[model samples]
Target: MPESVSAVLGPRYRAVAVPVDGGDLHVGVWEPEDAAATGAATPTAVLTHGITASHVSWAALARALPGVRLVAPDLRGRGRSRDLPAPYGMPRHADDVAAALDHLGVRDAVAVGHSMGAFVALVLADRHPHLVRSLHLVDGGMPLLPPPGVAPQDVAAAVLGPAADRLRMTFPSRTAYREFWSDHPALGPYRDEVVTAYVDYDLVGEEPELSPATRPAALEEDIRDLVDGASVQASLQGVPARPVTWYVAPRGLMDEVPPLYPDAARERWTRELPTLRLVAVDDVNHYTVVLGAHGVRQLLPHLEADLR
Candidate 1:
């Protein structure tokens, strides 16, 4: 592998494949460089990335919380595990994460999720309550109320737009893929090695024809669940009144003024889910919420709020 996105952050990591029903799930484990040097066990945080994202996306978080061990898995169909057979959905994703935790001998962990990962995290906590101690949702997990009379597929089309459309397209080279993202409104602000590492890892195949590793069919199912899935709904309703914090960026994927959750929608959700603790971080869009420096700086304090 090329230089890791988290290399300069003083974290030591190794990737392991944990066997599941369908296939082996690739899990990357990161530990504080200091702790690894001294050979001490640390508390662990199991991270789940957004749709079409791989474990590489958590490099920022691994750097930010070096004191805690990080366990991130490339959800089936998005990374090294892309070949894993489908039946993809939020619950299936949750089951895979739970299996990863168990395989690693981690009896309990703080589940961290970003975007669609938030929904997966919630279901993980619900399905395997004993394995998850607390839930941290970044810019997602809450049920998004689709516009009145809009079908689920139409809602996904409107919300995802280019993010989903790019799945069907192919790029000529990895550099071309990077160049493609360079023009992205949300990604433009973050033109760094970390971002490059992420986008480069996303592409696969020959120079003449390379495509993003994410499968459109799998992403479609996951997005559908985000909009209207029974498992997510049940998890939202079943989770106890615990102090779960959702760190939201104030902008959308395109760096739009109003974030994914507008003022009124945010207020309504807050009232509906009284147990959630919502914090709007400034100067970040949906993609930056977990990938950028400003967002990670805001996330660290919350991640280590109550170390057990």
Candidate 2:
């Protein structure tokens, strides 16, 4: 990484607590260098990270695109943000993001989401179309639910595996926690630069306990809320005509077992959401597709070019 990228990303990126209508939560906002001193408002790009990770998940991209101001809020109970008060779902995640945008006085700008965040982004566009200028999804697609006869336990384990682990865990120490994450299925593919920064940004205090900057139960609540009562695909209906797009990793989570995402299912979504623009990237898994140089490369055109 260049000195400029390093400086902007920070020797250690700071955590900010933003006051929202619902409550105070943590977020990591990276302002473009050109706009920092001048206080000139630049086009802000807010990224809602995936289910288990925090803003650090976007640090690599944020560093890559220093020209665009980036805001990555810890979704309600994930990252550095607050945990669930009652229960969480996609709607709550959207509400949290809407509050952040309002606090920032952002009228309209790009809203990007990844994995589960993509689902939340879709919900936002569906419920509050006027608030978004454009929407971009990186390695996140319209979540088509598993076909019938699928056991809820099996579905929950696969889709919400990491969330389940978090809820059931008590790390002996932060060192143990870090060790556990070093081999995470999703994050293993990122560059060392990204991995280091991603880890460093989320260290809270001397309790020596590590988490996504949110509580474990919060993540479970979020997953249940998003997938339990309604078909995950139904949320897409809310974002109609919002320029939906997907940067799909050709290999989905199904490779592990029971095949969560089938090609036929993907085709079905593409067919149903006729307007969705999907750009499939080859030779990448669910994790690597979102973290490497190629991942960052795939993201630029969507955020900077297509929106124009």
Candidate 3:
């Protein structure tokens, strides 16, 4: 029996199954009763969540922004779209956005991406230039390239952050998984109500074996790809000459220091691309930049000043 998604999103949001590439993509769209009142027709923003997170992370922000439509996909192998084929990278991720735009018939869009979603937004500019008119990169700066003089062992820890307890990461029960999230340092600040539905739709179980949609291979591949960078970074060789806005948080994964390459790369790219712009938000860590209400506040004014 297929899981009941309606049980997760309540009745306010419509769950649309978008078929693209090699699978069906699920998009949660918020369309109020009165279109004009909420600025639905005029303001449309397709959002992308960061790694390890789903559309639920963007729900508060999407709800707060007036006069805007919101479309949040679970990304390949995540949330409701867990069945998407593998080999996921930024380009294929960008293709997912393209598929969503084509399905929604959005000719030109104002795209907002957070973290991994930010990378997807940038790729949308590079790959599907005609599909997007403006871009808002949240916390995901330039493609983080491997730095010089960094050792292999240190590289993984430095770039991807504390080694994922990958081998030790699977869970056998939704209750346990929910508890894991409750104690997660990153998702802790978020209100329980907002993420409760998310926890339901995203976690999976298989009797004595349960786990998230996240595949260890995909995670490892993503890490390897970031380390390799020959593909995604090369794809960013020349960004579009349209409205491009980037937001960077003040803090990082730990109390140590934020990865400097991404910031440096964003600054460097800013100098090169005429339309490329940058905004650095103070007082928030890298994860908070898109996880909590405070992070959304940090992005609103910049998005308004630029997009509006």
Candidate 4:
């Protein structure tokens, strides 16, 4: 493990395989130091990563929350769970999370998610309300307005751009992969040991032809659902009645202006889901909204308040 991973994980981190329908889901658990000492039960949080990300994305948040048990899963078709068969979609991902929580004996967790994971979290809260006490949707969950003239299937490519494009390319070595991300406008500027470890974990094949661990099929299926699936629409409609907070990032995936949820869209959603609390986190893009220090700083207070 890299020094940063070691520092973030500390001594209580462990990887477990939670059995789902087809195969096991890879979950990373970070238990608080006092878990064994025990009086009151430890507060638990279930974290879901982005569409193309894995459990490793929660390293920084896990490190910050030493008193709360953080359960983060690599949603199907991403990270170590990439091999797990998928009839992949938001419902499937949500159920997988519920299964992980059941296997771990966790109930009433603060559900946190980023990017596409936010959609999964929303569905989880809707379908498995007993398991989620409150929702912290980081930079996602609202239905995105696809660019005009773009087909429904093309929305992912249009929004994700290089992130979606890189899945088809191959890298000769891990260094090449790191360099590729190092040049990313959003991730590159914030590269550190944690970010580097995240990049390293994303490569799974032989050195000569390593590719991103996200399966293109999974991405395609999930993105399609995210774009226009009925389930997501229903979840969005149900948001007002649920305990939910959406953290918005001003910048986008590629550090571009007009974020995934721009002001106009935010206003519309606000009008629809009157109770939805929106916090505008400036100076961070979609990726950094969770992965970077500034984003983490802004998120900690809200998360801690919810846990309390």
Candidate 5:
């Protein structure tokens, strides 16, 4: 059985199984309180999370955007969709994202994506142009080419750090998991109710032994492909010239200085992709750039304008 959206997001949301080639993709829908007044045509936004994250990662953003509808999917191999069969990559995820939109009767929506989710969002907009109104990329979606001769594993380690290692580590209890995250440099500083909720939702099974909902093998495949995949390069190379915005955090996953995309690289991206609007967000790291209060405020305007 797939995970329940209401289980994590509470009553205002609904979960649906969107059929795709591999299997049922789980999508969570967060409707505004005035949904009835707006009727069926209420503006919608599609929220896509990072590689190891699930639909619940967008709960904070959903609350920030009260009037607009939020459609977030657990992507293949994560959260409720963890059992989804292999062949996981950006294109497959893109297809699943498109299918989820169709299932929700959403013809088009503003695509909001964070980290790896940003790559999937770009692919979706590229492959299924009709379904995207505008694109808002949060610290991802742009090309992330690894340095020459670097292995995929090294690339994953450099990019994800403790986040990737946590997949293999087991926790005796949810509290243990929370404690582990509380110590993480990226997640530790911005500890709040929403962040705690996001961390708690990542746990599965019972006490004495609990594992993260993210599938390690799937995550590895995604990282390998993301670093050197042909499809990913194609997507980045061919992003639509539609209204697109990108937000980059000053810090990395470990709250390290210089961040994942350095100044030279960012300048190069702007030179190469003139259509992309890149904004520098200070103080917050990669994780905070999506889950933090300041990050949401910067993203709200782009999301709201596109929804309108």
Candidate 6:
């Protein structure tokens, strides 16, 4: 781990490699301050990251929830778990999350997912209902309606342009990688120690040929599952009956108009899953919806309500 990340996570953060099917999954655990001081059972939340993101992506949220234990995992094919073998999809990712929770003796956790993690969280709640108490989805989880003329298989490439494209590219150094993300419209504006630590932790290998830790194959498989997979479709069927709250970002991935879940999409999902509460977070884009302060502010109320 980078020094910046250590500083950002502070002294209470620890990394645990939980054994899974193919290999071990890297899980970042942040112990709650209040719970530790009073010897109370700390509240736990399982935070799943996006398609191309790692556990570090949840640093801000972890900091915001001082009394809640945050368990974030680098799902197979991303971050320190990048080398974990294939057969990756929503089910596999959800199982990995369950394994991490089991290893830590955590149950009935508030499952919070951002982006691709939202899809995983839904599947987790559906498959391992005993493991999750409630669901908090940020900018994802609801079915993504691809634009007209785009096939289901091509939605990953069409929607995730630069995010998926960077997997194949290599940077000369970590500084170069930082410079690359500094230009991202959504992330550039909020670039700080937390974001920089995330960027730095993303790079793996020696200098002059460093590359992103996320595997293209993983992103491809996960997106396809999210779009039209049988498992994801089945998971959606139970949303109306489950305790779920989804937060929508007004901006897109690049901080552009027409966010990932527009008003029409939200309306359609709301009608279908009438029980699913939808909150529109202002000013943040897809990435910022979880990485920025605005998104965290919107999430605090829901977390307090659900965990209380």
Q: How many residue pairs clash per model?
A: 0, 4, 0, 0, 0, 0
In model 6, the runs with Cα more than 4 Å from the true position are 37-40
Off by over 4 Å in 5: 1-10, 147-153
Indicate whether candidate 1 or candidate 4 has the larger lDDT: 4
The collision pairs in model 4 are none
Clashing pairs in 6: none
For candidate 5, the 10 contiguous residues with the lowest summed lDDT are: 1-10
Descending-TM-score candidate ranking: 6, 4, 1, 5, 2, 3
How accurate locally, in lDDT, is each candidate?
0.82, 0.65, 0.66, 0.88, 0.83, 0.88
lDDT of 4 by residue, 118-206 (tens): 99999999899899898999998887876668777777778976777889899998889889999999899899867887888887888
In model 5, how large is the Cα lDDT of residue 215? 93
Candidate 6 has a TM-score of 0.97
What TM-score does prediction 2 earn?
0.83
Global local distance difference test of model 6: 0.88
- Among the numbered candidates, top TM-score falls to 6
- Write one digit per residue (lDDT tens) for candidate 1, span 119-169: 999999888988888889998888776656777668777777788888888
Tens digit per residue, CA lDDT, model 2, 1-308: 22433454664344567786567867777767677554545777778887766666777687677666677788877645654364577877787888777777777768888877887777777666667777787666465465576665456555766546664555555556557667766555443766655554444444544443556666666665444435345666654566766777766543242233457656877887888787776666665555666767776776777434
Q: What is the C-alpha local distance difference test score of candidate 3?
A: 0.66
In the range 124-209, model 6's lDDT, one tens digit per residue, is 99999999889999998987887679876777677787898899999998889999999999898899888888899998899899
- Show where candidate 1 strays beyond 4 Å: 4-11, 34-41, 147-153
Instruction: Output the TM-score of candidate 4.
Output: 0.96
Question: Of 5 and 6, which scores higher on TM-score?
Answer: 6
Runs of candidate 2 with Cα error greater than 4 angstroms are 1-8, 11-15, 36-41, 147-149, 152-154, 189-191, 200-212, 225-234, 252-260
Listed in order, each prediction's TM-score against the native is 0.94, 0.83, 0.82, 0.96, 0.93, 0.97
